[model samples]
Target: MKRGVVLLGAALLLGGMGQAQTGSAGSKVPLATGTGGAVATVDLDASRAAMRILEAGGNAVDAAVAAAATLGVTEPFSCGIGGGGFMVIYLAKENRVVTIDHRETAPASFTPTVFIENGQPIPFDQRVTSGLSAGVPGTVRGWQEALSRYGTLSLRRVLTPAIVTARYGFVVDQNFRNQVQENEARFRAFTSTASLYLPNGQPPAVGRRINNPDLARTYETIARQGAAGFYTGEIAQAIAATVNNPPVAEGTTLNVRRGNMTLADLANYEARLRPPVVSTYRGYTIYGMQPPSSGGLTIAEALNIMEGYDLSAMSEPEAYQKYLEASRLAFADRGAYMADPEYTDVPRNGLLSREFAAERRALIGSQAAPGSVPPGDPFKFQTDPSYPLRPAPAGFEGNDTTHLTVSDRDGNIVAYTFTIESIGGNGMVVPGHGFLLNNELTDFDPVAPHPNVPEAGKRPRSSMSPTIVFREGKPVMALGSPGGSTIITTVLQTLFDVIDRKRTLAEAFTVPRFSQRNAATTGVDLGGENTPLAQGLAGLGYRWAPTPEIGRLTAIQFNPDGTVTAAAEPRRAGGGSALVQSGR
Candidate 1:
């Protein structure tokens, strides 16, 4: 690893560009309630930045974009311009919900067998550190489109907070340090990555300031030149070079494969505008992103199944069992049907239909599936319900992503989830651009004859479920999270908690979680292995292992008393931040 890095020089270089931000470095609040506006995120700086935007008269979309950009700096390992995500927006004035699908797209050179050779797939972990794992990023384009379409501020105006955060920097905390330590070996393989993240050949000390003037300059260019600065000129070329021919250390032992990305792919990228899927459960209408993301469909189907039962009438443990069973049933269909809409004909209507959910619900008996259940048949589609599933070729997705929720005084709301697909993605930073590349392409299935297999310019299916709930034509809640696939279950369970069990938002988030994603054994992040719930579930044919943690969720609720409440994970991601424009 490199030694004696000078992160301090960045502070000196950017000192004259603008005044550094104040009152955000130590702004950590896990829950806040008030009126006018609200913001919740997994980072102090990010949440504070959004709150500042709201205070400046920006709308929810503008504040959300501001928060997203700041997360690219403070939560660098999880997200940045190198990645892409889905944004769900509720426009109260228009009385409708719209979604932006900026999910990453594979290069034109990609093919179904890109990850396969000689009838075998590349080792998942080996591919994670290579150039072959990145996709054409869509975040910058997504941000530009959002601002042009619905935002009240310019890109330059909204990006000021992120630019300042990058220039002046934020203090490194334990979570940030722990993430670096976990990726140290891979980070050391690339000179550019190691030089910035691994100061003194180790994770930067907790409470130490780390600045990135290069990133600040990059943001400035995009601010001044709009998306063109990122997609058509120097920045785009740098990204392509970094992905096609990685900048590894001189004597590295890693076998990083070259990628297929090019300038054309970057220039041609578009953040497609999609209509949000609408589903109702217990009299509330839920809005979520459409296909190219299974989150909406899976969660809607699970909620439909859940609606079939009186979860409110059951004991806590009984409700947990039904939730697990519903999760498994939903994941079965997800594994079998969910994929990029452009390439795969996803059964949108059938998947979300109450009839389909009822059919699938019947298969869930008094006991869980003996091992794993197969996908059930949906209406208007002819297929055998018992078709054998292809065994998984590789498991490579990381539970690494960041979610932010924002709502303004006028009632506009946004729930955004973006990610680089893994912590310290690709473990290689663009030489001077000062950002990590995403391993998002690793989310694609490795083989052919599968809905999720890679295809030229095809966006990989994502599990990001940014959701907003509306009751009587007005938004009641907005929420999302950053676990890989467990994201679906996380959002589902929380929705059930508040709507069915009458739990407070804070109580819903604090409770232990049991995520069953159609797996033979449910992953238990519910406190511990020896918990009473765990012991009691064993008798019902349930098997589980400890997952340590599940997901860090951020949510905002529009209350009946004309006030708003923002809540974040109190114990996840070193505790999250929830800040309102004014205190209650």
Candidate 2:
């Protein structure tokens, strides 16, 4: 009875949580402003799902889980329980920042030579569709542990929105349809996958409702039985069986490989709590995920190097040159050093040290450095090597990922980025689970002596950068994105825009992004390769390549007047959704 009263009062606190929906499919607002709390995601339904939790007395952790689960339903192609991810959380009461590493792990049977046959490596795409590409999923355990550790809500409560979203379904948009169309051939190869996504033997039309009753049931069982429901029960058996003996339809010409996943691998899966990577740039404190994921360390190192230059004092093009140079140097170090920490000794603190940044920044000349550069030794920068080596790992050449940001009135914040690794995730849905398994294992380099090569029970190195920024002991903003290795560059550029360039959140999102990652040619997105900026940079010996898109970033900022600003992309991935408590 007491709980009921609390619920009623909480529900009435904000009359707009449910009524905040401004429109249906294509009319979502990219930037939202309000007083209490806020949520931002790539999908409108997901933002509303998180907002509902906030309106019902849930904190940022609760709302984030709710948002993530909702994304699992709506942004199914990008992320799901069948994949893995990274989570960074700010516990307001404790005033501490922490991270969860739920990245997918290689099966115990995995070896460095797993992807190598004869003297050559198997084609990467062939491995992707095979069960061998799937890693032991970690999203479910990450969610369960997060709720248990810092949330006022239960797993069952947080999962309610996702179950509802999956059961009744949501509106299909152009992006969803396009993704299906893109993976048409892959879908046709698996009957279970084709049955769910291609109901009429074709992609569903845009604006139509697509329901996943199987996924809803999957969620319901997990809600009742906890992580064990998926990791150790009947579902676990089903997952292993599907991976070991793919349910490919007869007459499918594609030769799919088998995985060595076992029921014990599922039963033993665990999400770990890792210390957050902390760095300071021009007085603002930044917190991000540690290695096994290189997003945090790489961003910190680049920003630390950029801090040497007074960007605000330079011309736009000059600043960009320095930005590109800083990114290049940082990525050189990332490619050479980063990997799963439990597998190798990482030179973490040295990579992020002020001295190392100064040394690396010194390498940037008046002209762009040619091609890929060698990594600098950061060991001398460390006073005591207090940090685990946390250099950014080389990102896989894939970009299908999703991010969400949430902040509560009480100051708690969550920045989460997750993925199924590649579009449509190896193109094999669980036999009856209605979710695609991740192709995360393909993230391995497969080269001999490579730190990121596959190893028994090793987590794949990732570039999912979930970041939180603090000003004078209080969290002022949170952000993250999904674009494999480019994720680090994307977040760093946006952070530079917001903190250094003094651009509004919306304006920052509009800037044409240039991503340089220690490559001979930098990738440009939201702008063509023939832009004036590109032409001008060509004089400096910088080369350019046009990438379709870079990243889909979501962020929330705490304003001085107590209002929160939630921002998303307006033109990418059919735009995104940003919502606040009441807009009052």
Who wins the TM-score comparison?
2
Backbone atom clashes (below 3 Å) for every candidate? 0, 5
Give model 2's clash tally.
5
Error of 1 at 564 (Å): 0.8
Candidate 1 positional error at 404, Å? 0.2
Displacement of the residue 236 alpha carbon in candidate 2, Å? 0.4
| TM values, all candidates | 0.94, 0.95
Q: Write the per-residue lDDT of candidate 1 for residues 320-421, one digit (tens) a residue.
A: 788889988888888888888888777777778778888887877766676667777664543323233343332346899989999998989999999999
Tens digits of per-residue lDDT for model 2, 434-465: 89999998888876676687899999788889
Clashing pairs in 1: none
Error of 1 at 432 (Å): 0.7
Candidate 2: regions farther than 4 A off? 1-26, 383-395
Number of the top candidate by lDDT?
2
Candidate lDDT scores, in order, read 0.85, 0.86
